[model samples]
Target: MAHPSSSHSRLFRASLLALPLLLGGAAWAQQPPPAASAAAPAADPGRHMLAEIQVIPRPVGTADDRYKHVDAAIAVIQASGLRYEVHGLGTVVEGPPEKIWPLLQAVHEATLQAGAERTLSIIKVSGGAQAGGPRVEDLVRKFRN
Candidate 1:
């Protein structure tokens, strides 16, 4: 029979040998792959785009009360003077991609800054040519008729 201390020492050595595998190897401490060294091409500021933004904050229950969060988001969109329409599920805004992207970011920040503890923003973007693209009205006018 093996001595108790000898068994314990064997178990300890075994555990030490398993530690690296359990912890995902020593590569965990190694630096990640270097980022792309080349500078990315600059985006064209005049590229036309359409975006739908929906901001949902927590504590959703009552309809009247929940609309305040939606209202807060709309206020930001209104303030930006961008062409937009407030639909049943979300607001659709159209402008240059450069403008619409930043405006979406601002809308999100404004909703949280206004006092929402948590916020979820859903954004859908459609990019098109710099000079022409479908607007919100064009997409929904058929349904309205």
Candidate 2:
């Protein structure tokens, strides 16, 4: 298997660093999501967005591996090009809610594709209708080292 180059790693790190600005800037708010120029803002008027999304895949444990299903669900999140950070209880994602919300469904379905009989998703979203909301850095920058 081919390994990811250092440039790809740097690119991904840059994406993470840039995510907060994207999620909390008037520039992003004024424009529509990449794919949905006209329909997205109408569907979700929030100027910026952040979501804590967690997926639980049932048959959550097996004799062979306790976290197999959970791993599959996480794989989907990692593969998504959107910027995200995985935390203890959930993974936080930042982007236009119109795009993030739809992607949540895909994350939820990933475990089922991995052979889980059932799945559940817990999601919490925060944003503003009149202006951009706080970015992750804005909320927890002090906690970082």
Candidate 3:
């Protein structure tokens, strides 16, 4: 019988050898996007991306306003002029990558500034490189009743 540690080492070596095969898609991603034809209309920057943001604030402080800290963060999103919808878990905001990326940082920082002892913001952003990703409605329309 081979030693368990030796067997595991051999398995690890095998996995390492397979890394390039597993990461072949990553190499494709690094390649430049195909050039757009002159006749194609450019995608609007304001409608190119969607971001889901969830902020959790600690030491909520009171029963009457348990979401006080969270609400403060939300206020920033509401005023940003970007299209957004607040769901049970998070708020989804839509716009360009340039705006959405920095705005995510603002939302996370807003909770801490709202007197939260600690805070966390989970964000998911979706977009494409050259063409542009789907709209919020395009993604969830079929699922809706």
lDDT of candidates 1 onward, in order: 0.81, 0.80, 0.83
Residue 132 displacement in candidate 2 (angstroms): 2.1
Can you write out model 3's per-residue Cα lDDT over 3-91, one digit (the tens) per residue? 99999999999988777668785576468888877784544654588899999879653477888888888889998888999998999
Local error of candidate 1 at 105, Å? 0.6
In order of TM-score, best first, we have 3, 1, 2
Per-residue lDDT of model 1, residues 1-145, tens digit only: 8889999999999999878668887675365868885975466755678999988876422355756666778999999888999988889999877678889998887777767778899999998765678888888888994
Residue pairs with colliding backbones in model 3 are: none
- lDDT tens readout by residue for model 2, 41-112: 465445678989887778875768887777777787788777788888788988777778887888888878
Looking at candidate 1, what is the lDDT of residue 51? Answer: 97
Q: After superposition, how far is residue 25 of candidate 2 from its true place, in Å?
A: 42
**Model 1 weakest 10-residue run by lDDT:** 58-67
For residue 79, what is the lDDT in candidate 1? Answer: 92
| Candidate 3 minimal-lDDT segment of 10 residues | 38-47
Q: Where does candidate 3 stray beyond 4 Å?
A: 1-47, 61-64
